[model samples]
Target: MYRFSYSEILEDAPQLARERERMAFDRALHLLRTVEARGERGAERTAAIAFVQDLWNVLLSDLLDPENALPEALRSDLVSIGAWTMGEVGEALRAPERSLAALIEVNTSIRDGLQ
Candidate 1:
């Protein structure tokens, strides 16, 4: 069996942050696409949406933390985006036919910013 450790892969602060954000965005993209195809119905879609919400919840928590190292302005911006994401998740859940472009664009933009 192959075992992977994040601590070993991300030994520096910069690399760690970038890789973490990239992974989070990738997860969001995957879940979003899954829900899109499933039309937001059934347990699978619900679980995917919940997972996406949890990702943003963690982002929001990190941005809100007083000990976070990010600049105030950047943290504020991310918090705002996080709030938008939470709302988007609710909207997407309510309207199964809604476009996931917004969610995908947000994740992609944030992921790119980390690079």
Candidate 2:
């Protein structure tokens, strides 16, 4: 077995974390598009809403934590973006002929940026 250096360990953890985050966004994006195509009355809508809500909830909690490594300004901006995203989720449910374009767009942007 090979031993890992401390710097490698640190670098590896964040890279892994970013990949996980990217995958989570990927899942959410897929669900959102499925919901769009299938209509909001189906199981797909239920799943998409649940996944997006849960994903953002976890991210917001992390960003709000005082010990979070992200800079304060960046964290604050993300929190604001999350708030908007959550509002869109609510609207997507409550409005007739609701379009998930905003949700899809924002999540796609963030997912692409995770690289």
Candidate 3:
């Protein structure tokens, strides 16, 4: 087995960040779709929303941090999007039948922006 060092991974921060964002969105999309299809409304749905919320929290934290390297305008845009996402998640949970198109579109837009 080949092991990658933590430092080595951090060396490619841009690529890693993009990949992570894409993966997070994909996971969120899968979870949302599953819940929408089966109406399970169980642990999986909770976990899915949690995952998305967690992603936004990280983005918000980075945007708020003064030490972060991202430009002010870009950070502001991300924060706005993150806030909107949280609101959408709340609405989705309340009405499981409501379409997830908004959330999906937002995730796709963000993922594409990261590319």
lDDT accuracy of residue 59 in candidate 2: 84
* Number of the candidate with higher TM-score, 1 or 2: 2
> Candidate 2 versus the native: TM-score?
0.84
| lDDT head-to-head 1 vs 2, winner | 2
C-alpha TM-score for every candidate: 0.79, 0.84, 0.76
The global Cα lDDT (0 to 1) of model 3 is 0.75
lDDT for each candidate structure: 0.78, 0.82, 0.75
Quick one: best lDDT, which candidate?
2
Task: Please list all clashing residue pairs in model 3, or write none if there are none.
Answer: none
In model 1, which runs have C-alpha deviations exceeding 4 angstroms? 1-12, 37-40
Q: How do the candidates rank by TM-score, highest first? A: 2, 1, 3
**Alpha-carbon runs more than 4 Å astray in model 3:** 1-12
Better of 2 and 3 by TM-score: 2
